[model samples]
Target chain A: MTLCTFIKAGLLGGILLAAAPLQADDLEIYGFMQVSGSSQTWDEDYGASLEADGALVGTWIDHAQQANAIAGSEMFPWQGLVGLKDNTRNDISFNLQQLNVILKKRFNRQWSSFVNFEVVENYKTDYAQESEWGSFSVQEAFVRYAPSARWTFKFGKFVPTFGNFYEIYNRTPLQPYLFRPLIFEKSVGGILPPEDYLPNTMAAQVSGTLRTGIGKLDYALFLGNSEESYFAENGRNDTDAKCIGGRFGIRRGLFKAGVSGSYDYDRLDALDLGNDVVLAIDYKVPRMRYGVDFSGSAGPVSFVCEGIFVVYDLDSDQQAVVDASHAAGTSADNTLDKSFFYAHLQYDAAKWFVYGDYDFVNDGIQPWGKDGVNALIGGGGIRLTDSITWKFQVAQYSYEVSVPHPLFGAPDPLAALGGDLTPVNAPAAGVYKGTILDVQTGISIAF
Target chain B: MKYTLTLLVLALIALRATAGVSVIAHPDVDAGSVDKITLADIYSLDLLALGDSDLIVFDLSDADPVREGFYAAIGKEHDKMKKLWLRAKLTGSGEPPTAVASLEEMAREVAATPGGIGYVDSASVPKGVKVLATFE
Candidate 1:
């Protein structure tokens, strides 16, 4: 939709959806500002530079969607899951990020309903702006049934049941950095991209806290439509099989730990040489992902460490096709097993706070040797007030394999094909190896 | 004169440092002296039931000297506690303790409402509310 349509749609939705009007005192207005001046070297060696004009304003369809986009691919995993080319080099300015309107009111002693109406600007640094559902999407609209203090049930569209990062820190005000770690992102690749990381899903979930000997235990159970898909089933997938995912956590001493994961099954038609070498046929891609996270706080220091792994399983026909492609010197791993990991350590003293994070991925989405990113980021923030901070940060990304043909430098055969050109046999050059520096100063506020 | 000023300053610091915390509840509440863990849970909105009675939490204003003493006694900082409440509000968890302007107001509300629990400085403890715990 155009910018005009987006504004009108949001207004209409806001008016129509104000049924049980929240009491003025019941409504909480919270949002954050990300004012930053950044200079990025997409590849310093090539002198490829992009300047941030200092201010970014984006909230195209949902809260933080563009912020999520502008975070960019620390290591872009896939190229064409949705049949669109992602031009990241031109995406330089994305700020003025998120505004969240949360209405939570208790209906009775037993029930309360929560609704979040989020508005975002869908603008690109480049010349294309597109949104499937205009520029207004419900971040979360749900009702909670709290039978007791320890147990609760939710029904409606809400944050997808996935990881702590998405549920907790995905908000602009909450995130210490502008971009998210690659593990929480769904990139392009595999027979079909898994419907794992879509920001929100319509679901029914039950969660609660338990007083167990193993610290205080918390658990969540979710079953929903694994929407984001390329297969025939879009917005809802694998009718025969639904996505089952949740998290289990417990706090012990000064530390809190949890394990969470999801599984999705999908089917698609594969075009291939089929012995006679003519057409691509049909196959199924069933994928599973799991992760473990631990966080702790001591004195003025707090830290979190998380590791996630996703594996895509191929059936006999798919394996046969991969074998055929391999025999023909096309590069496709037998059964895609990808791993991603990130760890964060942070410390705070008086008015200043500092942090360091490491992100690594063995995505197997790209060609061999070019399949991972080891990035270390360190930064600090000075608190100007309880709600505002000034932060400066630097990030350095180290590629597992050196790219023979750097981005925008030489024409790379595989890079040209993108992820849409499957099998990725031409052995595309890996990520450009060099000193890629991203330096930014931000004024952040949350209320 | 300098010596007198220093003594005055020390006395004010001492007064701020030693504000006694009174964890107050409704007179109808049947709970006994709450342990440190239970107090933490109540303030964090994690523990809602005290025996047969369900409890709601309230707080003196963030800038209240008594509130600062209460948080410190529980081994928490005011800013950190506020952030925790912010997360709770955002994540569909329980809401934060409603802030009242003064300890007398907090104590009075706790005393009148069934299951209402709150903290105040001992100096402002009003009638009808029972002191469930104290941090000296």
Candidate 2:
């Protein structure tokens, strides 16, 4: 059956089941919806030079276009790269950020099950008219068995315990800000693909907690399929390797601290330059990530912070291909070692709360000709009622990079056509810099 | 003399407004009493079982003053507790406690259901239940 038909059928089945006469305590259904409006303004000082026949040729281009071109290019995997057109541009949009529905069933005290379905970005599934911005899918479905309070096992698909916020970042009602910290916001694909930095989902998990004199110790170990590229047609491991990860933590009252680590094989359809032609090359590399996080609350104020480092182990051949196709002149060391960290603080009261967040990322590849990217965000929310909240946020991002991209100065692919190309008069010592100011307001309803 | 009497009555009213609560459980539960840390764990949905029986936690409505006092005594915030419960439910760890309308209902439900637990004002310790913890 078609995808739309399947979705309709599944929804109908859920409705019918809910309508069935079951004990209220045995079955539960609940969800939340978030709607947001955003305004973004970009300010950039970008410049590039064009050369013909190895001679200086002046080509004046719009600064906004230059920024957009570089951002949209495959060189950098920055988040929100899509739909960027100009510098000093003001773009406004209203979006249904997310709609999530959860179904939970309890079969005695030892056995239980849960399923979460999420529709994101104003998802529409009409066969006659489909939306371009939104998507619909089941985020998680799992069955859990708890023989005791301290021991439990989960089977099926579920988000494994990672750095504190990875599992709950998408649950808008649980978060105080309209936009999550940069490292955890997967919806806006950026420097760190949370999938690569942390295992996003797992098939089976074993977890437990131990109460201690000082605090409670929590631990979880999970196994899942290998990470695959976006081009992968099916949600299956492309290689024999599997992803394995675990987290361990201690909690006392409102204080918690944790360390998490994961190992996985990543398969990507990378680009290869051969005989002045760009070709798609499938490459597999082993990746390892380690992270540390802690959070605590003191009266009306609370704070949280986490740091992560990722290392990609590529063979000599794979490294050679990456150097040739991706990071030609960006860095002398093409090792792909990335790190990210963020700190957040918030003040919460009975009816309102305010928060501040700062995060930084070093995209291992350094596509922007800069050391790293930094974001500072401040936001607040008002509790309209027990089930509704209104939130607002203002975020600023800053990064520096060279325009015309240093790659253009490399062996020109157009040279084979009797044209020698080069870049002249590049920015003098880190003159090109860009900043983005994003303001968003949203309302969330939980049922 | 009239002014002094009025002040005395106001002080009495303030004292009653800040009255504490008693954590109660079904009579069959083996645990006699609990500390603040254990009480926080139970109400936060982290502690799922008491003794041999699985725990069934109940609460008064969100706006209830006794509910607020119960959380205050345990040193937890309402918003934080809500988020904790949400996380537990989504991750399949546990579910939020069922909420009743009033203290009387909370006492009745906890008394009727085996393994049930709830809290009520210190002044009203109903029959058919054992007081596990009290905060004054």
Candidate 3:
């Protein structure tokens, strides 16, 4: 059987075992649907999207997001490489948000298990294969064991233990914005995956809380295959090596702060090309990631800030594993690095909220703020009712280098034309520069 | 419209009759009372077993005013409660309380299960179910 088939069968088996039909009458079901009308102007290209999104059991799932929800999440496995890049856009389409089936079993107090099976559209192949329903992906299939109130051991597959937001991504109705910040979105395609923010994976984690004089401390240490997540793309690790990391945080009244880190090894394979292709060497990347996060809530105001840095070192050349035929040129150096920063502040008074978000990503030579993709968001939410929320946000996106930045298509035509409106594909001496205005209004529901 | 308003008024009157909530547990549960924070932790599944005894939490249907009032008294909204459990389940944490159809049904379940904990109208606390506390 193929690797994909093997992985799918194993994942299905694990979740099904956790799903062992406990009590039919005790099953609980819940989820949310985020329906929105989004209008975006990518430099000169303008379009509007009618959107319906869902993600987990109780949570919901989506084929629209890259496999990285499984990609590299504190909730899933570790991080991995990017999905196959696409540079095309469709104006009008309908997507069935998705649904989740969950079975939670509690065998006394020390042992309990959670199993979730999600069915989401396979959008990657939706266009290629017209006749397709959806497929099931295991978001969480894990058992928890607590020896004491201060100690808990989790066995089976689960999301990594990272920061605070990993556990709250699906509660969209409570959030003021419909779209994720640039930090989570960029890290997925860049070096780290967005798994930490969305889905957890098949792994093990130990977590607990302790009371102190100053505050209560909660922490988790996760050990698993760094390459295991990104399930949508079938990007599990190819070897038996393990990835280890954890997060430790303190909660003092209305404020919370924490630090988290993870380390992994990606064993690049050795490839052979008869005579013409030359030899590709196998190398192991000691990938390291570390970040700090802080959150505070003071009555009508709340804020969160997080910063993560990634370093991947290699002792080889650019052409070692990069095939010559690939479109994006290979990196010229052996050491790869990235820094991501995200912060958000919201003030809620009356029935409405005033909020702003600043997110930036810096990858190697293409440093952020120096023209890398950066996003500025200003938005608010109106609580139409307790169950329904109406959110409107304007996300201002700026890209210094235009390489198929999904929201902002890669279309640069003028380095030479002075403003007379040159041909759309004319050759240019400089890089493409432009700002994208993305305005979205969403009516979110939760029950 | 007149009939709908009349039905609404009747429903309000019925809810008022059961507005008071009594925290109930298995007859053999060790604790005679539970604090609001501990109650919240139990509902959130953060505190799995309560005070040396294993626990299986149950709740009246979300629409029950007593259940709503109990959570509201503990500084939680019904919507936020759902979101909290939703996040827990999706994130692979503990499960939400199993929901019973009504206060009577929830009381019956709590009475029979060794470690079961639930809430019901104070006036309707069934036999074999121990009342931990009564709050309005």
Candidate 3: how large is its RMSD?
11.8
Compare the candidates by DockQ and give the number of the best one: 2
Overall lDDT per candidate, in order of appearance: 0.61, 0.73, 0.60
In terms of TM-score, how similar is model 2 to the real structure? 0.82
Say which candidate scores most in lDDT. Answer: 2
Ranking by TM-score: 2, 1, 3
Give the Cα error of residue A26 in candidate 3, in Å.
5.2
Standalone chain B TM-score for every prediction? 0.89, 0.85, 0.84
The C-alpha local distance difference test score for the whole of candidate 1 amounts to: 0.61
Q: Cα RMSD to native, each candidate?
A: 8.9, 7.0, 11.8
Which residue ranges in model 2 land beyond 4 Å of their true spot? A1-25, A47-86, A123-133, A190-192, A230-234, A269-282, A323-327, A330-333, A402-431, B1-9, B18-20
Lowest-sum lDDT 10-residue window in model 1 chain A: A54-63
Assess each model's interface with DockQ, reporting 2 decimals per model: 0.51, 0.54, 0.22
lDDT of 2 by residue, A25-86 (tens): 67777788898888888776653333333322322243333343443344333322122222
Give the alpha carbon lDDT tens digit for every residue of A1-447 in model 3. Answer: 346645655675675565456446454444455556666665522111211121121111112222223333343212221122112232222343334556666665577776666544323323433213335566667788876657888888766667656555444654676766764432123333463222234377888887676877888888876554312355656555567888899987668999988877544453221111222434455667787899987778889998877766555464334423122322222234667788999997657788999988665333122345678999988888766788888888776442223321223211121222221222222234556677777676664
Better of 2 and 3 by lDDT: 2
